[model samples]
Target: MVAKAVVKPAVELPVRADEDSWTEAELAEVRATLEAEMAALVAEIAHAESTIAEDGGGDGAGDDQADAGAKTYEREHEMALAHNARDLLVQCERAVRRMDAGTYGVCESCTRPIGKARLQAFPRATMCVACKQREERR
Candidate 1:
């Protein structure tokens, strides 16, 4: 007698479809999108860090006064931009973590499933459209 080998399907994050449990396919699609976003954000953060380090000059030595001022300004600007990138990266990581925890589709504010269209555009979003708008108005 030949033994039959069974292949189990991969487990994926749960996504809500029309207020119902998401099929494995839907979850897989959303998971792929979120994972891609997380990877891109991490790469962007790394690039920003390296660029900031290259532009940063700790001491004012071997530079003219005007050049030093320009370097200082540029460093500060670069640091601010890098900080924003880091913040976005954090959000992306959080979203990925939520996916792993089986809570990826819900809004953090109202505990509702985030809209599908919104998720498509912003994979790292933590709030639903209503909550986001309310927060913005405050």
Candidate 2:
């Protein structure tokens, strides 16, 4: 009988230090990144809303159904974009709150430390890469 090789999963990197161990500089960097993102998101949402509103206004130049349909489609697309931006803004704001609470960079699911690289790429990530991947697999 041939024995099957037992494969083990690769161990994830050790949990990075918690926020408590982080220097003021580290926390400040995250705070600044989150705040900047929030500001950008808010501005984007505002601009999208304004544009959508303007597009919805009937200039009375073309009262045809085709023009109305086209305008409707455009308004819908812009609203979707604004909604996505709003969601991102909420996430950024939540990250800021977590920073203030000294819980930023900690995975919400496994409670593991989210790596600095991941954090740098996505300052509002609430889950570590491993946990996020696992969640996606489900």
Clash pairs of candidate 2? none
Candidate 1 residues 25-134, lDDT tens each? 76567668767866886787788778888766367778899998898888788778778877877887777677666677688899877865677678788888999999
Q: Rate the local accuracy (lDDT) of all candidates.
A: 0.72, 0.76
- Which ten-residue region of model 2 has the weakest summed lDDT? 6-15
Model 2, residue 95: C-alpha shift (Å):
0.3
Model 1 lDDT-worst window of ten: 5-14
How far is 42's C-alpha from truth in model 2 (Å)? 1.2
After TM-score superposition, the amount by which residue 79's alpha carbon in candidate 1 deviates from its true location, in angstroms, is 1.4
